[model samples]
Target: MAAPNDVQISIPKNDIEEQGFKDFDYSQRAQWLRAAVLGANDGLVTIASLMIGIGAVNEDARAMVLTGFAGLVAGACSMAIGEFVSVYSQLEIEVAQMKREKRVGERGEKEEEREKEQLPNPMQAAMASALAFSLGAMVPLLAAAFIVDHKVRLGVVVGAVSLALVVFGWVGAVLGGTHVVRSCARVLVGGWMAMAITFGLTKLIGSSGMQL
Candidate 1:
């Protein structure tokens, strides 16, 4: 019944749909990359730092190697446990929050959908978070295992660990929807404090003729 000029117009929806799909793909890839970086960086830095501080005081190759081995086992296990606990705790809290949010969401679908939060199973989230954390804390230690000189290796580990923590903390903060500057500063400050304490203890013990 419409005139020729009033003919129905059809728009191609594929372009938009395709673009959205690509964007989602890219986002997922980016998140994976970020998690990888975090895990590797943490592993490299923490273990290295621990080795460096220990090596600084004990110059013996045997001792260094032993310490490094111990560090590797301790760090990896600690990372796994800590990450599991932390992630599990967070998952519990987030699940509770989302449950409450779900009720609110049901009350107002439009508003809730507009502010819809994605809450997955606690076990899943916890497992993922813990895995990421443990992996992050494992890299530098592994690197140190291959290095030869105890002292030099230790120093390398310290530097690498500090750098790694800074990078990981900053990146993590960004992912967590927080301020990178604050997270970075927090990590850096803690590193400096730890170094100071380690060295100070060494000095105090040396003066007292007691080896720490």
Candidate 2:
């Protein structure tokens, strides 16, 4: 039954397993990365635009820094609470789904545990979101905190916010397996528009007969 020209190809089990692991679903990590990216970008953009708006009307470094600080605290807390509630709701729904599917029987114990491992952790997500927001909001606050000259402080905040925006974009892109250049450009342009609009509108209002 043997032929000299016959050949058999065999693949090792180990190699098959390694390939399986390598081809894992990337969407699994998308949930966590989405929260982090959203929190960071929101914190940076909100505080930067707010500070720029104030700077457009007033030259006091103290007021701008204080406002930024207050915003950072409030933002971090809001992000944490929001993420916690959202993820907890998701977790509850998934748990209810497993129960409704009758996946909690004795024979299903192992499978149930495995499925639970994939569920989102509300506390972990909340902490990560809050920390990311605080870290992002700190960029502009630190940039404008020490500088006394209003114009220079404004310039530095803009520069620092720009740099941080690029960094956040790149980091988010890398984590999410996306195009870095496009992400960075989009983030930077959006940030610029927000700052420009806030500064322009606030300036117009201040320059007009609007007292305050």
Candidate 3:
């Protein structure tokens, strides 16, 4: 009986419920996970390689501990500065892109809307990367601290690094919604290869009577 203009459009309850059940936004998580996993993987590999290389040549506990501690401090600082610079550069590029978009006719509002939805935070990302690196680096350092025997310490460091790499890979995969086992295996192999290379080189150099 109602006039055509008087008829109201009603949204279906299913559609409304579907909106409420929408999957969680994973974009931000992917960003953080990339930075964090990279940081952790680097920290674990670098420190473990350093310790294992040193252990291969010399069995002095003092030397191993000192070297590891130095690597931890130096690596952490380097990672922080590097991450900050990298993220800041990315931010600059994004800003430049936005400016360019704005200069284009009839696309400024659309560009602005898109940019507004997700603005990258360089400072936050840098801090997160640095902290994650430090945390990851501590695993090997702590594992080495408990053992006085240099050879045993080296073994423990390798084990710790392997475990950490697997965990980080799995965590990253889960966060990014990928194949967890494949990611874990990839990281595990990579870490072992790095350590082996470093250890072999150091052993070769030491056996050649080269002191450095």
Candidate 4:
């Protein structure tokens, strides 16, 4: 029998679970986590899709290996360079814009005294943007490396990459408080365009009697 003066208290287990879930989501880390997942996924899809398309034309194992290897090298380097340049360019634009805005703000400080002023911090903005862009681009290329078969590998990588791009774009839009559907659509469309162009070019080169 419990004493009359004693009190019993119970805490729901779900309360902690809910709290943890909330903590794990909607943070800066969320973006990075999403980036890594999407990047790896993109790499896989891109390579896979490329390989499949190549296989459709011919079933030579040597050709497939050559194609896959070329893709791996070309894709990885392209991703790295693209990531660096895109990030660099984005940082430059952001810095330039911020500086311009800051200059204007300073010139009109007296008139805009009532409004809050945002001073441009070029260093911080550049660093953050560069880091984000590099990491985002690296994800897909890394995922493509795991595939073994040359042609099939390329095909799988392409498909995975395309899917990853859309997923990442959606994730980015959500984080930025924009339309998820539009962002995802843009990525998908862009990926398809890239695939088409690449396939077309490869076909042209092959038909031109260029030995791989």
Q: Whose lDDT is greatest here? A: 2
How do the residues 120-171 of candidate 3 rate in per-residue lDDT, one tens digit apiece?
A: 6777777778888878888888888879877788889999889999999999
The global C-alpha lDDT for each of the candidates, from Candidate 1 onward, is: 0.59, 0.90, 0.84, 0.57
Ranking by lDDT: 2, 3, 1, 4
Better of 1 and 3 by TM-score: 3
List the candidate numbers ranked by TM-score, top first.
3, 2, 1, 4
lDDT of 2 by residue, 1-212 (tens): 86988888899999999898668766888778988988899889999988999898889898899889999999999999999999999999988877766754644676567566778989989998998899989999999999999999999999999999999999988877679999999999999999999999999999997654
> If scored against the real structure, what TM-score would every candidate get?
0.54, 0.83, 0.84, 0.48
User: Total clashing residue pairs per candidate?
Assistant: 12, 0, 0, 30
Give the higher-lDDT candidate: 1 or 3. 3
Best by TM-score: 3
TM-score of 4: 0.48
* Candidate 4 or 3, higher lDDT: 3
Off by over 4 Å in 3: 1-25, 108-112
Candidate 2 at residue 119, lDDT? 89
Q: Write the per-residue lDDT of candidate 1 for residues 39-141, one digit (tens) a residue.
A: 4444454444555556657666556456655655665556546555655676678767657877776656754663454433334433444465556545455
The Cα error of candidate 4 at residue 30, in Å, is 18
Is candidate 1 or 2 superior in lDDT?
2
Worst 10 residues of 2 by lDDT: 103-112
